[model samples]
Target: MNKIQQQKSENISFNYFSLLSLMFVKKYNIQINQKNEKNILSFYS
Candidate 1:
């Protein structure tokens, strides 16, 4: 393959990876929030 085409594919893959990471972070944040709430309640009790 030509260099330009190879570079284009690499860029596309990088973008896809970034999108996946963003989604994962969002899901992680939700779980963290719920866990934090439970922990706070237990500590207070």
Candidate 2:
């Protein structure tokens, strides 16, 4: 329950969520070589 432990937990959560998001994008047949410029732009838009 210390500050350092809390920071580490937050970092691990972020890494896990990021990995899950990437897997989701691929699972739905999303292309990764579209320069990611318009891809992300349209994705979040």
Candidate 3:
């Protein structure tokens, strides 16, 4: 009973952590893409 509750809480926390990391990764990717675009434009110029 108590163990089950603890397990549930752990699962919830793990899920939340993954969601936060996913958002962080998406933001990082967008930044990288913007940098790449700037590099490409500079190269053409």
Off by over 4 Å in 2: 30-45
lDDT of 2 by residue, 1-45 (tens): 699999999999999999999899886645564556687888788
Candidate 1 lDDT by residue in tens digits, 1-45: 699999999999999999999999989977887879987678779
Worst 10 residues of 1 by lDDT: 35-44
State the C-alpha lDDT per candidate.
Answer: 0.90, 0.81, 0.92
Give me the displacement of residue 17 in model 1, in angstroms.
Answer: 0.8
Task: Tell me which of candidates 1 and 3 scores higher on TM-score.
Answer: 3
Angstrom error at residue 29, model 3: 0.5
Q: Candidate 2, 14: how far from true, in Å?
A: 0.7
> Clashes in candidate 1: how many?
0
Candidate 1: which stretches are off by over 4 Å? Answer: 36-45
Clashing residue pairs, backbone N/CA/C < 3 A, model 3: none
Return whichever of 1 and 3 wins on lDDT. Answer: 3
User: Arrange candidates by lDDT, highest first: which order?
Assistant: 3, 1, 2
